[model samples]
Target chain A: MRPPPKSWPPTKGSEPLPNAPRIAPPVSAARPAGKLRGARALSGPLPWLLPALIMLGLFYLYPIAEALRLAFTDARLFDQATEPSLDSIRRVSQSAALPVILQNTLVYTVASVLGQLGLGMAIAILVVRAERARLRGTMALRTLVLAAWVIPAIANGVIWQLLFSEAPFGAINSALRMVGFAPVAWLSDPSNAMLSAVIATIWQGTAYSMILLYAALKSIDPALNEAAAIDNATGFERFWFITLPHLRAALLVNAILILIMTLNMFDTILSLTGGGPGRATEVLSLFAYNTVFQSFELGRGAVLSILLLIISLTLTAAMVVFLPRERK
Target chain B: MTFRAIPAAFALLATTAPVWAEDLITRNRVGPADAPNALTFRLTAFDLYSADPATAAHFGDLFTDFILAHPGWRIDTQLQTGAIAQEQARIIEQTRAGRGPDCAMIDSSQLATFKEAGLLAPMTPFFTQEQIDDLFPFVREGVTDANGDIAALWWFTDLRVLYRDVTLVPEPPQTWADLQQAAEVVAAQGLEGILFNAGRDEASAFDWLAHFWAQGGELVDDTGRPVFFEGENREKFLSAVAFFADLVESGAAPRRVTALSSYDDLLASAVAGSTGMFIGGNWMYNQIQITMPPEQAANWAVSELPGPTPEQRATGTGGWTIAALTDDPAKTEICAGIAQLYAGPGNAFQGLLPTSVSLFEEFETFAGPEFDVFVSALQNGRARPSVPIYPEISNQIQILLGNVLSGSMTAEAALDEAAAEVMAAYERL
Candidate 1:
């Protein structure tokens, strides 16, 4: 409101000496023209960014537009007539299996994300509290935990498949037999298939959540913890009040990412149970894939994909709004 | 030379040597000519290479010979690996893009889909009427398009047969009752009586259809409407499903078969001595030789699938059929020649049952008595319904079989459910 203090602009002599520093105006009170100049300075890299922008428009935006367009038509893989119709949307709504598939999808996504977050948080906390003498061993354990995440999803699915195989040679079944227990149908039975898939997913997914939370945990002030320790606060109380509150940002980010990934899981389920032993683990993604590729119904697949996109966007928006803001 | 010159020389060699070496190898293999052009032929049944390496080797040798025969032309056999449904989808994409292979080894069951889409070129221009007539009736009927023209050439094929452990069974089943009796005897010995696909998948559909046909059931009536929902046909369908259910109920087969997928799994179970019998293709013999130790493999023997009556032998035939896809007429003619050569009498040693009836006698000498059973089964083998709706119907049947196998539905209820679904799919088509 009033002119800033004379020293705010750096007091200067009446005679302008050669190579003297200039008295610049305050940034908050800069003129509109000066603001335009600031914006123009940021545009220097625009030409260099053109190729990336064009690529994203072509590969990402174009497919999304095409899917939206196809969602309104009754198109198939081999059909000649693709008349504009809402029949695909109607069919999806009327499908008896849709309700079951949607429920399965929700269960898989929620269970997988929570399992990953819980296990990852535990591992991250343990790693943070490890003694300096055991740092090497802790680091090795972290690497071993992340190894499953580093492999391809298909390879991970195959490894789990072998472990849960119903055959006598299956690792889990063989171990059970060794312990004088009957072998369980880990993948074959309807009841166990979803649980088996969720367990495998948690194994592959926890590593990512751990890394993010671990980094966030490292940034928390140790002095707060020392103060709490001096107060004779329990370890659980320290974690619940201090460590958890500090991890809110990382937790929100990790949860949203893992939620989207779990919703879109296709290849792993495909290579594992294939949505079967009678559609026991047939989630929305698998249902959409089968509708398009197996049933040759492209329109139906597009509609389901749009539905998935809506759910993902809603969850992301909710997380962004509810997550705590970091103070500057 | 200077040190910099030596590094430059090494870089030059790395860049230039492989290209020159490849050129020399290509020239030596294809022979010197103007410019060797690649004739890309997509093969759908690439698993045959793993199933029978000798047959695959023969195919490659024949392809090389054909390339040499045509100057300036080299053959490229592109292996497209997937389940039959996935491979068919790939072919549809290729054709819709107007970038089809020069030729493709297609599945006989899939010819109807391709023919309907106009993806296959008619063979009327290439083969004379007499030559076309030489093809067996079922083979001719299977590849005929809507225009009543042969769109593909039938090559090697196989029919489902009952395979049993010779030491366990001592006598092969000749009828449904015989099978039940044999199964009981085998089960009494603390071994599983049968191993077959009963899951909700393509393999289940194919394996179950053999029994369906054997019981005198028809998939579609004369007008192309599915008839399995009607009285007599419906009864037969129920009976066929009940057979597998009864097997599990009677402790002749393991309850685990409700989750079994492919004949490969059946072979594994058989090799492990968990099951005494299974219904599979003649190719199972080749697979057994590949997967099992010699002592275990020697225990297996093949026989015609037992029917409702001993005299009524029935099975379903399926295998690869060669179809021309090139737009160029000259290339089409060349593709026809290659197709004929591969399916012709000269390579019977490959062990696939030749479609040529004339070669049967010669094939028998080396094919042995086990293959004679396959040949006899083919005489009465029913071709799958060649319609666009067949895949949908197959899916419905798979669901029905899975329901029955899992004991979730009575045979009657499952059949009714499947019939309604099949009819719905047919109406949509």
Candidate 2:
């Protein structure tokens, strides 16, 4: 799979003008990909750029090509690749579990985005107000929230899985029972399982949203806030009128990033639920992973992967169009 | 440095180099390559290999023995995962990537898939005729191919059984009604009861399928096509699912049982003393010994898993096996020797049951009266279908358990849906 080796200082087959050679050119033993330029005309700066180009082709370009190739073929574990066909796409389309997987993906992405933004905005405002009043424990509180964010995703899953265990065994459920509430199956039930995963995701992600909104809040002019206060504005009035507008750009950016990340979330949920309780918590990424790695249906996995990629790209493009333009 | 020596060096490289299996497939290896004496052979290690300190010490002592017996030989084992299915998945993945272990320890159910994929070759050469003859009758039939060659050597086996605290339930449950009644009484006393794996795991299917098997129900036809939905098999399947569902419905067992993926989880609950009765593996006893106080461990006892009727009784046997992936005859022979260590001496201290009929006769550890239930249960024990398509059937069965337990679908609907999926997978194959 390696590209043919390149030799420096073109010898007998140099195609450039023989009269005036500006510099000795490096010739590729093979033609450049896609005929972007002639083999001989690949001159000036290209030789210097060859290493980067090769790395890009090898890592990014080649993998995409192979994935695309596999998507149209029949592939399996320890089986030889066969003729190009639409069998994998057909298999995915005909899957009895596809609809539920897609629905879970949508619910997970939306719930995670909303939960993170709502909780993140609340924390951001509280921290900013405390900082303005010069209150105690402001830094400590921020650090605590960031601590959840800094833990690895897998560890986050394990911690939450323990906390969400059933009844007397679960920390949260035990606390609930102590307060005269009946135990709830946080993970055993399908609906609660998705909710549990969303809560864990929001707990980990809220810090990033908080940091973004915090920076935006600090960017606002202090004089404007004083003027608003002089204008007989209530605390809520200032927050609604001035602070919300200032945070709009950050919030939009945060929403877009969070949605994409949640769409592809795998590790935490994998450790927590493993798409269990009858594939109730299986999202798009987990479905693709199980299909390819666990089921050993390479073609089916590739098809699912392409569908996920298309969904992410389309959403990103749509979100980009709504972004506030910078002044020229 | 001399031109005359170049040919001699090329000859040396050719003689020492590994002979790859396919089109330029390099046998991936990593270790101290410059070491003068030792050669590293990466072997697949089970997740249970180092699950606890005692287990680590006991399992480690065997490797220490192997190294002592063969100087300059190193064993590099990895690919440990908590769930058996995950471990199985990793084995196939590693082999697909050409980084597979030189000797792989895999679940017995995976042998057919490995053989069909051409990932395995005849193991007969490495094994002695006498050693081959020493395998348990069922194991011998299970391991040998149609060509009269040994495909793999099973090291150990286990059985599914229903466990209970004898003090909590003075009488063992022999039928579904008895199990439900016993659980209800325990539930009245503020204790959990009648738990089993009903999760998205193989145990969800493997553990409960024995109830159907006890009634002489066929999950698949002789040709290896699923027929659990046809005629008497249909009634058997529905009755098995409904009985468990009825327990959950009657508040005899919690819906949280659907979340357990491993017997180790069930063992943890049993050790905590909240559980009155649960369906689990014989190995859980060994785990309880390592983890629980002796008095607490003694309180627990196992019986043949309950059946639909008191007259019916069966236990499903499952085990792990070792296969040599190396084509080199020398390494294959070494792997065979290691397999013997696992089947006889290594399994002795690990709490795993011996796969050799002769060894089982002499092992004093299994001579106790309590283990009689397990030894007797083996008479009616059945193994899961070992066809390549069995994974598909087992996967759908796992989903069927999850869906039925979570109240997402009815038993009839779930069974029909699972059957449709299995048939679809069969057509693809």
Candidate 3:
């Protein structure tokens, strides 16, 4: 009788075997405590991260919130009056120097960021190639590139200031005299003040970009270069295709960071130009500082600070949105 | 066995009779490292040590002598250095916290601010009426509160005067026209003919106010109202702006003159021979001597600032004052004594003028020949308006002058704007 039917087991189970291994109904897809498995796992890490969160809340978010709140008040450092108003914002908006300050800030941000990026990328590539070629003293050369980054920005500013001074003993003027060219008022002339500040800033900030780019370059697999070389690609073509594609993430991040740094820079300009030659180099940061500490117009300064924060945040958001995404 | 023996020995000692049998040793009561009674005086000034070593040393000596005289009281002096504005801010913070020095060296310009902040103690309690009256009227006014009580002690004074290179100008300019003519001649000689503190700060205002006063401008009237917007004051403000603007426009002064923020900058320009003339304080004489070669120093001389007319000559008298910040009468008296010694007569500042009229003769003898010009300047000079809003007023003047000098605005337009802004600031105050 068993050999009589080849389809003894029906294609569809019309009937179940009573003695077959009883399996419990598939466990209900429910998470404990009505939470995802990893959701509650954050608690283990939360204690470890509490300090950093507290620090950011206190030092970063707190100041920003306070500044925003103050932007609506007519606050003075020494005044006891606490009248809440938008007069400061209105006053800042109507200021005549506001246009010039914005222009300078824009020019400075563009020039310095571009300068740093261009120089940083070039130097990073060169150093990477030098190392690949086993060139002697490449390490020393790289370290030299990092020198400006190691020195404090204010000290760097002062050094550049001395070099750019209109004084006869200034390094730039002395060099010009040696070359029989007329000494240029590097810092004193309105035309040159912002340019001088940009140059000083680039000198200091290039190292940061270079460092990031260099690390990115090193992370790039050398096998890609080898493959390109085998395909008869030139150095430029290899870098354009293989190296650059890998560096997109680093380049975008570095650009954002440098842009923010340049926008917020205050002490360097304070020490170097003092926003002088008729406020020629007075960026928003300097203007905010002057309004707050120097002029003691706290509310006006807060207004400027809020504007700066908004600009920075907008730019950051734009960059994050528009920049190419990294491969998963 | 050892524990039992130790307890027995301790018990024997504890049971010993006459615990106070040994004569109690008498010694001087313990005190701080300083003498039993010590006074710590804190002073904040621009340059207590490096700016003028002799004066700083004299102060140290005076404190030393005071300690020597007062047998029980040891004197302790703590000096901090920074811009006078910064010092004033620090003093304000310290006083508000009730932890400031017993006294602070306040700038004459800072008196109004300190008084308004209620940081100053009236000097009437510590100083005699005769002594208060003996100060120069402007000096007295600088340290006097709204109620006409002396709020601080004025000791040494400074007057803004015209500094010139003797080789370029054999005689100081007697009028604004003379100054212009001299500047033109000096400019023709391929030198920056003039360097005023055309900087966009209080220095510019301080320098321009001399010209403003000469042109008969008043920052605030006797009734403490801003009157710069009308009549003679408006005209004078306009004229002063035009004069400064002309210096920059005509290339008589360096276009870089717009960058000179401090008298120190002018002094440097003078010492470097880059400027043929400048307006600065008499304190520059010592700085010139300290910073310049003998020949270079000799080439520079100071005179009373030129006026619109010889009869209309004016200068600015500014100085530092010692404001008593302590509530303790004893501390206040001690601070007053130190302030008097530092700024009072017979200290022989040696080119620095004393603020007291009573000390003029004695100061003149030690102040040397250059101080004669300073004396004339002091006699003719007026203190800037000691209103709480003076800093704001001064800043507006600086902005106006800076705008004119930079060709951003015409003198008439700039002064009009400045006058309006100043009145607004006054109203706010």
Q: Number of the top candidate by DockQ?
A: 2
Clashing pairs in 1: none
lDDT of 2 by residue, B1-429 (tens): 799799989887785463221111112322222323333243444422454567556655565566556644555545445455566666666776777766777688777777767666578987778878877676777777667878778888888988899998888898889999999998888878778888767777889889889888887787878888889999998888888889999988988877877676687678777789999888887777778899888888888887878879888788988877766666666677778778876777665777766777777777776568877877767877767677777778877888898999999999998888777767666
lDDT of each: 0.77, 0.78, 0.76
**Where does the lowest 10-residue lDDT sum fall in candidate 3 chain A?**
A2-11
Best candidate (score: TM-score): 1
lDDT of 1 at B161: 85
Return whichever of 1 and 3 wins on DockQ. 1
Weakest 10 consecutive residues of candidate 2 chain B by summed lDDT: B19-28
State the interface C-alpha RMSD of candidate 1. 2.2
Query: Each predicted complex: what DockQ?
Result: 0.33, 0.39, 0.22
- Give one digit per residue, the lDDT tens place, for model 3 in B120-155: 777678888888878888887778787887788886
Relative to the real complex, the DockQ score for model 1 comes to 0.33
Off by over 4 Å in 1: A1-50, A130-136, B1-38, B44-57, B345-349, B362-366, B416-424
lDDT of 2 at B309: 85
Give the TM-scores of the predictions, in the order they appear. Answer: 0.86, 0.85, 0.83
TM-score ranking, best first: 1, 2, 3
What docking class should model 2 receive?
acceptable
Q: In candidate 2 chain A, what residue range of length 10 has the lowest lDDT sum?
A: A22-31
Model 2: residues >4 Å from true position, as ranges?
A1-57, B1-58, B83-87
Ranking by DockQ: 2, 1, 3
